[model samples]
Target: MTRAEGRPLRADAQRNRDKILSAAVRVFAEDGLSAHLERIAKEAGVGSGTLYRNFPTREVLIEAAYRNELAKLCDAAPQLLESMPPKQALRAWMGHFIDYATAKLGMAEALRALVESGVDPYVRSKEMMLDALASLLEAGAQAGTIRADISATDMFAALTGIALASGKPEQREQAERLLDLTLDGLRTSPR
Candidate 1:
């Protein structure tokens, strides 16, 4: 439903695209590259034509799905902060990050294959993640609930370490404990 150059997508078209991307993420994560586009269309409640129109190729769909998930995770930062104290917001956001990480692991093999085919599926991932971390940290620091010296990069590394170390269901408890420890370390001393 896009028009000539510089025109915005029609609302229905945008909705269809969003649906397709969301469905693609779940399908790809669950089934990897073996997931069929027709199945994705069914999951999205859209026609195959709509899915094809939005994403012409498998690589394009995979890349778009991964980017869409990243955007959803990163976009949660401000919404969480708005509804809760910054410390709580950061903690909540961490949980969302964990979920994102889990889905990401499922999609990793497919994304790697996409990269092997010369399509980088994560062009803006690092920057987007860093920005999300920075926002959460900044909110917490401004509220005097978190230390100011922590770098977003360092925090992201810590989260990634925790996720990788305890990503398994059997190690979920330990992972939670580690995440709590990391969160505890972010607190500033009461002045």
Candidate 2:
């Protein structure tokens, strides 16, 4: 709801921004970074002017879309914990991770373009993901459902490897199996 410069967006502006980001994610994933700005605007149900006001440029939109997806994935950790048992929450969060990975994979070209443009969209990505994983692991460990020996860093690396290996849509079955395997490894006892 706030701009990168920390200025709060008006409610309508926020809505438009959210729409544009969502649309951009889908559009970029389907059409790549060279996707037309007008197409994105139309997909968002906003005018070109509104989209321009919100994003300013293709790279800016790509970065925002990717960051938005990352935030959603990271923010799901506590919410998942609040709604389910810790181990269950971890499993559910891993599903969310797969979804995030799919989107990231879909936008790979767009992100590469953003990186080439001198903006590191992943600047806080690892830290945020690790924090989320740590919170979930700690909760599960305290609940005695998951091993306390696992480090968030280790889990993250494993998850990243799985994502890299099975991130495509057709590879979802394999990704789920890998996730289950990873979760099994994290369990205090095999279940």
Which candidate achieves the best TM-score against the true structure? 2
lDDT of 2 by residue, 122-142 (tens): 998999999999999999999
Q: TM-score for each prediction?
A: 0.88, 0.93
lDDT of candidates 1 onward, in order = 0.87, 0.92
* Per-structure clash totals for the candidates: 0, 0
Task: List where candidate 2 sits over 4 angstroms from the true fold.
Answer: 4-7
Error of 2 at 26 (Å): 1.5
lDDT of 1 by residue, 59-108 (tens): 98888888888888999999998999999999988887877787788788
Clash pairs detected, candidate 2: none
Clashing pairs in 1: none
